[model samples]
Target: MQIAYLMNTYPVTSATFIRREIAALEAQGVSVRRFAVRPWDQQLVDDADRQEQTRTTYLLAPGGLRLVLLTMAESLRNPRGFWRAAKTAWTLYRNAGRGALVRHVAYLMEAVHLKRLANGCTHVHAHFSTNTAAVALLCARLGGPGYSFTAHGPDEFLDPGAASLGLKLQMARFAVAITEFARVQLALAGGMGIWPKLHVVRCGVDVTDLRPAPPPATDAPFVCVGRLCVQKAQEHIVAALADLHQTHPQARVILIGDGDTRPAITAAIARHGLGEHVELRGWADNAAVKDALSGARALLLPSFAEGLPIVIMEAHALGRPVISTYIAGIPELVDQQTGWLVPAGDVPALAAAMRACMDTPPEELASMGAMARARVEAAHDVTRNATDLKALFSRYV
Candidate 1:
């Protein structure tokens, strides 16, 4: 099957394991084409360059003031129609807007983009269930075969009046939710009655290739992997550092990934005088992250929401335990058995969990980590997960 892949981001270094998934699909005999939005990120350029394959790229014709205005007005409405109208308007916006003169201009440009794309893709699938999906839906309607998208957190779930619901239900052939929790949230919030259309395909890891966690060490407390975003709750993890230090003074947090919140997360760590104990190593590439995972005691992901986070699965795959918040599809992955689940945004509880984790015996943690690996092998492997997704795509075919 030929698939046209779409995404708001091709790669941001910290995200876009999506590239690897696409590569895997291609290796499995799927003819794949890519469509992405800009401003183009370097990480994407690197991956695309490394593959040495050229893809037809399209960018919105910049300077569409009228388009922005129309989308803004449409998005400000009530909880229900906001996303729908806004999405419809934004498609017009992306191509340039719905104004009388611009409509034909935008339509002509869209047609050109498609002609350049040279349609043979069976399904057009966007990574996130938002703007890119809207773009893909328009492409499908403009004579691409069918469309689908993978829905994950933050903006898609948090935006109340987002124009994603109906677009997801009626436009796309079938949508994939990273977790069942994400699917439920889409139904409850997106006003998509046809929630059954969602296929819960996890963001998976390279199952057999996962490097096992390093043998228990005396110094490292926990490893946190994620961008320094408020959604990640890095401050909450930093807040718990002091409480953790009183007992496991030798323990330190090795933070991976960086973003706008780095300064705030750093300041919080310092305010508590735990700077010596927290190491913000900025962004590490996937290989380096795996090395850290191999060496760390446990993985900590206290994010406020998610759609089956890949970090948790990586931790489990490598036989390293996880400490995460209970929200969205997180609970579906984490539990009393795999790892500890802390309350979302709770500083004290998070702090206590850290202390307890540090104090837990190495042997016990290893045992827990083993259980974590078992969970991934049983439920989150990408091969099995891909088959399920292919089945969903076939229904639309």
Candidate 2:
């Protein structure tokens, strides 16, 4: 069966899980038409993502005039559908905060274009219950394909009204959550009546592609893989390192992602005299990330909010334990056995976990890494999870 996959942006550096999921679906004989609101203008680290860029059609690529023309054409072709979709967009705009009118209008135009593009697809599925979902919802109202979306939090949970989460869920044929925690949040946002529409389909990593590597020495530097953002709380990692450095000066940490928080993290590293102990490696491709994880003692991500990071699974697949927080779906996968679990924003607790990683014996660490690998193989195999998604799509189609 043919399907349309929509997103706000495609072929990005951090969202490789989506790429993997699409690839797995294609391998199972599903034809996927990729659509995005816009293309990633930044450098993509992975060649797979680069290839995906060629396959994705950007609805906004034609700019304002083209979108206006398409909207006009769509309205003339299906005046009734256009009117219905326009009303939905108006409702969304009224529900949103100040300055959201322009955004909703753009979503309306994008939906008009998507309605033309996704004509024959059985259904459309979007990642993130944000603008992509908004556009998808509007497109369905425009008599396009029925659409569903996957909600990843805690951004979605932070402000459901701004995202129009309830309305999106109410209109969607089915909704997917990356974790059970995320599913619960979707149910809360969409109301209990829509609970039957919510399903848990985890973002997964390919275990075969990311096979376990030899465990690193206990004293090896830790690696953190994620965007350097406020939600990731990477600055807290620097603070914890500073505290850890007071006792273990030889300890080292490598941060393997990049974002707006680089300046703050860099300043903190300098302020704490941790230039030698902390290295901001910026963005690395998938191969480089796996290599970095292979050599690291463990993965560290003290995120203030998350919907289960794919990096944690990647590290676990590589037989490396994680040092993360007890937030969202993390505790479901990571605990004392997998790696260290510290309270978010607690610099002292983070420092203690860092110390624990430093002092843990190599054999014990390997044992923990083995358990981590087992957990990932059991719960996060990409092919298996994709099959579950395929089943859901089949039921709808």
Q: Which number leads on lDDT?
A: 2
Q: lDDT per residue, candidate 1, 1-397, as tens digits? A: 8777766655456554676677667666677776666544444324443452245354453345644543444334332444433345454454432353454344333433542364676777888866676666655544456788888875677653445455455777777878777777667754656667777787777787895665668776589998789888888887777777777777788898878899898888879888788899887767778888888888888888666778888888998888888887787777877678888888788878777777788888888888888888878777777767667766886
lDDT values of the candidates? Answer: 0.70, 0.92
Candidate 1, after superposition: displacement of residue 324 in Å? 1.0
Task: Give the best candidate by TM-score.
Answer: 2
- How would you encode candidate 2's per-residue C-alpha lDDT over 1-397 as one tens digit per residue? 8999999989899999999999999999999999999999799878889999999999998899999999999899999999999999998998887899898999999999998888899899999999999999999999999999998888878888877899999999999999999999998888999998799988899999988888696468989999999989999998998888888888899999899999999999999989988889999999999999999988999999999999999999999989999999999899999899988899899999989988888899889989999999989998999999999999976
Give the true-structure RMSD of model 2: 1.1
In model 2, the Cα lDDT at residue 390 comes to: 94
Each prediction's RMSD to truth: 6.5, 1.1
For each candidate in turn, the TM-score is 0.84, 0.98
